[model samples]
Target: MAFEQPLDRTAPSISEAIDHERGRQESTLGMIASENHVSESVLEAQGSVLTNKYAEGYPGGRYYGGCQHVDTVEELAIEHAKDLFGMDHANVQPHSGTQANMGVYFSVLEPGDRILSLSLSHGGHLSHGHDVNFSGQLYDVEQYEVDPETGYIDYDAVASHALEVDPDIVVSGSSAYPREFDYERINEIADDVDAYHLADIAHVTGLIAAGVHASPAEHADFVTGSTHKTIRAGRGGFIMCDTEHADDIDSAIFPGAQGGPLMHNVAGKAVGFAEAQTSEFESYAEQVVANATRLAERFTERGLALVSGGTDKHLLLVDLRDSHPGLTGKQAEAALNDVGIIVNKNTVPGETRSPMVTSGIRVGTPALTTRSFEEAEMGIVADLIVDVLDTPDDDAVHDRVTSTVDDLCEEFPIYE
Candidate 1:
């Protein structure tokens, strides 16, 4: 039997928007650090009929019936996650990385528990304890900052701060940080402070899986991550622990944070983890880092000051202060958007501008790497981005860059 949908008959506008979004993806470069293109198989799994079922509880102990097949999906996802991260146990629920962090916090942290995390403008995630996020509102939050001169985490300073605050939990991870973290150092700091160490490896899941970067699973007490970023999985989150806290983690994700699991997404996670297990995925992950390195080199060669001087991962933060002093991140982001090169405005270390109008733009190479882009092509793309920033007011240059991007997209068709 074949499945077919007359989307135009039921929802023409929504279908059109979906198609248009696909077109946009195919035409434009997606430079967001936290985004990637899932495979067609993963997409199929995510859009499957499993969405109709509600799997509220764990496999073989669900509150609802008819979850036998979805149980297999979730179990496969869980098993793959354990193998992928080399963890003793895995929970493939939580809906997102934010919720995964929430699950870890709920499992161990009480309301108003002391928490120490990296500051937002310095590369930490909002869920880490931003004033607007639940983590902040519920916990007693303290933040650490990147070193102004180096644009990187100051481990010594972090240890000093950790000792001063004596937090119940110390969070290590970032949304826009490009360099690899010293997980061992952080673990030591947490141990010294007698705090739970939670590593949110949401941004570098693919690199860690590929062994291109260090794994936080072996060092942190709890590990939470998203499946969608560099992992090339569909949108979802997961938690990893040493099996001693498995029950509590599961309980936190289920009753404490999220309700029913999205079984279709579980299927997608299974499929994606299977993909990540292959040697091809390892090569892809390597290329992602190489491309990012190439992009950063080219950007620096173009006189754009890169945060931390360079990246050891698939993303980079470009500080436009010295290079394009008059141009705000918002302005640069808009100029890049006009030329079909997508990037996000982000706050740099010691930022004076607001978050919305940041002094930095964070660029990444994951989605492009998924589309089979390599270092040489990444060099060209970086030049195109710098060209747009250089002549933001020149329509002719924008037209040229736009056409070049179109050519590049044609050369690297996502579906083909």
Candidate 2:
């Protein structure tokens, strides 16, 4: 059975845009490394009547009335999160990954405090300490970068800098960078400096959930993630800390960063977390990585230069400077978008180009794999991606690529 209730009667333009976006997804390839398609169940929970409630405080300690049922939803989300990540405490609010980081900082640091994190251009996220963001604006921020040669995090360099800067919190985790971080090593440096290690696993939440990527729960003093990314939950953020700092985290999240929690999204988180606990989700996560590996191998075989040479998780960064000299990341992005294969322009390490017009493209497999695409399908898609880039302006190549993308999207329908 389907929900036959119509949206046009209530909101024509909004409903039209929603329908158009759905049709867009149904036709194009979603290759953006930071994106994924959520399950219909998750979508339903997010769209539930729970959205009409007010839940201002934690489970029982409510700042508002009529929160009993919403309390249950939030408790389930928190407990499921604790179990999923093996943490002593979980705050399922914060609105987004940046807000989650904000909560952590509020719990620990004062303004003007020193913060050490990866550079945004070198795979770090804005919330970590980009100057335009509050993290950089309020705090004294410094950054560590990938080894310009290997395109990997320079561990020794980070340790040396951490020791010298003695930052209040050393944040680890990134939006790009294809390799893994030695959390234990970073943990040691944080300990030596008597600083807290805030591991923002916003990108690898699903991999960590599936045990494919190492969990930072044991190593970092604070761990934050986006529920939407690899986790495929609602668009929200979370923070996990030990019980010793649980109250601080909860306080920082509520009165500090956000007001009433989005109960519907909290319900959605509970649903997604339950889904993640199953064996099927574990298999799905593993397959996501496998598909990425296949795509990386294909790209390598086709002579494209990959950041860190390849991927160990669900995403990879392709540096196009060597493979396609004149074609900037912006150009490649526009060309791929025209042909129905969606991807984002990214900046590689030692990038000289402007952020808006970078020299690389970041691609991932989580979305396609969620569409039930296997290694074989990934190979074909990878070939098509290379084909578009090889002849971006050729009308015939664009037509062929668009046709193949449509066929694949039809074969692996998302929400129909």
Considering every candidate listed, which one attains the maximal lDDT?
A: 1
lDDT of each: 0.93, 0.91
User: Given candidate 1, what's the lDDT at residue 241?
Assistant: 95
RMSD of each: 1.6, 2.2
- Model 1 RMSD in Å is 1.6
Tell me the spans in candidate 1 whose CA falls farther than 4 Å from its real position: 1-5
Tens-place lDDT digits, model 2, residues 177-217: 78878999999989989999999999989889988888988
- How many residue pairs clash per model? 0, 0
Question: What TM value does model 1 have?
Answer: 0.98
Worst 10 residues of 2 by lDDT: 1-10
Model 1, 1-416: lDDT tens per residue? Answer: 12365787577898899999999999999998888999999999999999899999999999998988999999999898889999999999879999999999999999999989999999999999998999999999999988999888999999999999899999999998888999989999999989999999999998999899999987999999999999988688999999799999999999889899888888898999989999999999999999999998999899999999999999999999999999999999999998898999999998999999999999999999999999889999999999889999998998999999999999999997
| lDDT value, candidate 2, whole model | 0.91
